[model samples]
Target: MSGRQLYFKCECLQKGGAFKFRGACNAVFSLNDEDASKGVVTHSSGNHAAALALAAKLRGIPSYIVIPKNAPTCKIENVKRYGGQIVWSEASVQSREEVANKVWQETGAIFIHPYNDGRILSGQGTISLEILEQVPHIDTLVVPISGGGLISGIALAAKSINPAIRIFAAEPKGANDAALSKAAGRIIRLPETDTIADGLRAFLGDFTWPVVRDLVEDIITVEDSEIIKATKLCFEILKVVVEPSGAIGLAAVLSDTFQKNPSWKECNHIGIVISGGNVDLAVLWDSLKKGK
Candidate 1:
């Protein structure tokens, strides 16, 4: 355990069991009546798909979800339960965008970029406001980075409120595009990603990259093994069900990269964003069986 006062901002217990619902709802409800009539469309691996589907359902509009063939079963089921029209795609960003484009063209639906839109970023930023209010004295936040929406939004809002507050991005080493981008001082896209934390596979988008570059304190990369260990700790010790991506913030906090950092010595009151809880039981059982 980290020798710090770790305050958990549990977005895992959100409406769609992930912080994604905040952005999806904002994007869906922000649409005008005419645009809403055409419905909404997007591509996602899992959490965002379910979030958008549920948001559209609440707004009485259809949601077209282009999902990769290899998305977690539990997430796919969530989309189905929320009445989304599923469009299957190959497990690649290009394939997902192509399929989503086709749907958008055919249906004339408003396209919602999962983590790249300003509306979505503002919605996710609400987390920072809530966190600061809930833990007034906290000076740092450890957030999991995927497409960069969550952390970008957080860094923007948190820094606006408390300029001295630190915002660290938590990333899986396998999908370390953001880390690479931060280091190279430019956006870096990975041709392929290989990470057990499916939700963290995405790279930063144009809108998110600028905020991350300027406001984020640093990137803490953790191994998949470390993520699994954090997931196990959440289940056994914290009694919280967290997906691997959601637990990556905790993983990063416990990682040697963070522990060994002399600059972070004064960051004693830390806040960790538990981003989601939509775990695949099969994956969970398998990891437990392997005792990782």
Candidate 2:
């Protein structure tokens, strides 16, 4: 009765068009009625901001989102459509954080950190919890690492439920700060990051680093090209439209990064967290045509 025979947990169908909703909902629901009514603020390039916006809306609370000026227009629109108040900042990551902080100071809004808060982590952890229940026995779990909140939560939940379940964090090679930090045994900040996977662009947050370092088994890097290919493959094979960052986990597995392990062949029960499906249609079409 090995875990490999169990079914896979397809979280791509989660609310808000990504698995992020789990954590967002969890964090928002955990807030006391008073704090929740005070409203919330967060900074995100895309998916997380939308998740928070939707979650806050569900809670009958207002949300302020700080997004980089150059963030995908689709993501910005999603945030606004979900009832979030958007504050635009310089396209750079630093400015987004600064703007979010400024909003917090001015509004005195409760800051619902995108990845660093314990409540957020616990919320993200629920993805793994559901996966385990759905699949029953999962041998390997693949997750994309951005600010490390998602992977950190999944790793903790998966490991606690079954320590034998190996957890790997997939990241874009261009944005490999998490991998470098893991190797260095400390948090490493990238001076500059240039990756089409906007969701994975940020450096790991302080709260997320420790959980990832201690709980995660390994961090693997994938090229941007591979991510593109994987994204297209998901559209073709799974009939799911995944953003570049969301497809990293599947890209790593399909690219043979973990194929060398004999255990993988014997126990083919690999659970990939297909995190989001928020790609811009125009960008997707252009990338496909260019790749072809």
Best by TM-score: 1
* Residue lDDT tens for model 1, 199-237: 999989999999999999899999989999999999898
Assess candidate 1 and give its lDDT.
Answer: 0.94
User: lDDT for each of the candidates?
Assistant: 0.94, 0.83
Q: Compared with the true structure, what per-residue lDDT tens digits does model 2 show for residues 101-199?
A: 999898878998888888888888998888889887678888899888898898888889998888888998898999999999999999888777878
Candidate 1 worst ten-residue window by lDDT: 283-292
- Output the TM-score of candidate 1: 0.98
Clashing residue pairs for model 1 = none
